[model samples]
Target: MVYKELTGTSVRLPANFTGKRFLTIIALNHAMESSKPVCSDGITRDISAALIRNVTLEHAAWTETVICQKGLPYLLQSNLQKVPLYNSTTCLSKCNLIAETTLADYFPATHISGSKDHDISDFICQFLPLYTNETLVYLPNDHIVLNWEVEESGSQVDDFYVGLGLDATEKDSPSLVDYISTDRKPYFKHRHEAIGSNELFYIFIKTVNKAGLSNIAILGPFLIDQTPPQYKYIPRVKISEESILFAWESDTFYDDEQTAEINQLAFQFGRLSCV
Candidate 1:
């Protein structure tokens, strides 16, 4: 008669027995394991007064409500015995029956004040477009793709909010009103022109679960570069009888704090016939 999914602070017991008197016991499972000698005489005596109850039934069908603490395992037992009139003693008779059951608290207790301190890092393990180097560089017109992974435990995530700001402090303490709500998809895409150009920005993500627990994750100090490289002066060419030389001057573009160098250069040669 084990109850598998008991939750909250109370339990209802409906019983149908053919006895004049009944004894009910509800105690923590750990306490019951250590104090098994209380029922040595089969009459369930010497038990804690608070954990035991005596019930006299007027009808065969009866309901009893037991109050208990949440988030713990408990053992419940009901014994139907006979009281002899001659000896005035309670004893187990041939018709006596004992029913034992184990009850488990399914829903763990939640503290509203402590929920705000929950570690969001456990919920989101990874965030995309991370700044590995000095900065995560991107072009102004490029679509920024953000992706992440959520932990499998705890309550399901009900909503996601993303925030983009120009400073790290903004990411640390993001305003919910400034954040954009998103679906449960693991990835979100920021379309071109959605963000301003040539600015360093930080990304903040907040996840709220169905239980009202929320956590925030921060990523980036990414840079969006709108300026392109430009030539400082016109190219100069030198031609000799057997060889040719080409040279040009250009302004350096600093990417990753390093001067951008040309990886390759191409040229085409053609012969013109005199008519």
Candidate 2:
């Protein structure tokens, strides 16, 4: 007797997540831990906070010294008759090599190389950086009044943008549109836009400098609607002094490993605002 097989629906299995080897990018929770150390630049390892006070707090600037006062001692100590004190400026002061160097034998000192403390800086030279702060300075109302601050400022800033965010998946192909700027500051699409707007839009921003567009600074995907709840006009909003407000016994901020599948289920009704 030949047995005829009857066709039936086979059970479908979930995706094989078990025992699968996959790559994961691990990052430290900066909020809970300290970060790494920093290095310093050479030549002028002796920096004073007074110097920063002297520098302008505007746009980032760089300065290079053709000749320097401090280099004479280093050169004279190194026993080089005529050495160069090449001092260059950069945004940061955490690098190798000396920035300030002296010109060889170009000393204006009439008498063969004068004394050490003979106003070395006066006979030599000095160069330092000056930066001015670039800001999204805004003025809300027009009293036709002037802002005493930034009255004598000079700037060459082109433009700026601000928005919500993008997912890590579509970092390459993003929908960059609906951008707006009025007086250099951006008033683009945020999560707090018209009702029903998505709370996720990439905040890609860049500035067109003298060297073309600078690197796109993706600040954050701020859920702008992350604001706490607000109260509206409720005239009879009376509350008894003997009212008791209750809450759950759990914290919200969690790591992916700790707040896995089963853990998320615990927050089904956890609409908390306070920490």
Candidate 3:
């Protein structure tokens, strides 16, 4: 339920980028390039840590553009065709090393404009692709619902989806599950009763600004067995003197270290019927 925890360094972008004006959301879908050793807030942190800052401080999806500046390198739409997104940890943690040059180079001052902004402010862009990676877990019987809270003025979001696919097993594939996005909700749930017992699935969250999924929350691990249950039903007789003795295989114990299931049952029965 926790998102938007920023911990790295950020500087006020050049005045021309924003025209000293309104805010826009930037989502990077790429990794930052730098020759220098990575650090967080200019201090040496984990280089392996990822850069996961949100792109837009305050804005929506419609009013944005990737303006190809004159003679500047443009991001190829075909580049986006390559799947298996940038490498980073799970959702909500860490910073990826970024350089001023890298940021400026990727999102050079472009004339991007839309409805929300009357005047197109020079925008700030990052080197990495934001908002492309989203994660989701679905609950049935109402299946899902997003958090109905607003954090910032521009925290209103609604670009996401949720569906189920069976081919995506093992954590190595682009998950087949999708969730509809909403605003300011740590977790959004818009679908209903979508998961099946036989299906293996994944969920994707939508981000308008350049965002990354970091150290996400953990889930439950269920234990299951394919073997059937073994039982013993016995009847006994009332007797004046009774002594029962039973012995079974000690090997019929289930061990956590073992890969097999073991069960043992033994009983002594005495029966008497009289007229």
> Which candidate's lDDT is highest?
1
Report the C-alpha displacement of residue 28, candidate 3, in angstroms.
Answer: 42
Taking all chains together, the TM-score of candidate 3 against the true structure is 0.23
Q: Please give the TM-score that candidate 2 achieves against the real structure.
A: 0.23
Deviating ranges (above 4 Å) for candidate 1? 1-136, 142-155, 172-177, 190-196, 211-215, 238-245, 249-275
lDDT of 2 at 169: 34
TM-score of each: 0.38, 0.23, 0.23
Candidate 1: 10-residue stretch with minimal lDDT: 58-67
What local lDDT does model 1 show for residue 253?
24
Quick one: ranking by TM-score, best first?
Answer: 1, 3, 2
Kindly report the root-mean-square deviation of model 2 from the true structure over all alpha carbons.
32.6
Weakest 10 consecutive residues of candidate 2 by summed lDDT: 46-55
Candidate 3's residue-wise lDDT over 106-194, tens digit each? 21122223412312211212332322112112122334333221122322232332233343332222334433344424445444344
Candidate 2 per-residue lDDT, tens place, 29-142, comes to 548453353322311111111100011111111122222334332222111122232232321121122444222222222223442333442233322211111111111111
* Candidate 3 weakest ten by summed lDDT: 56-65
Candidate 1: which pairs clash?
none
Model 2 misplaced regions, further than 4 Å: 1-155, 163-165, 168-178, 186-199, 224-248, 251-275
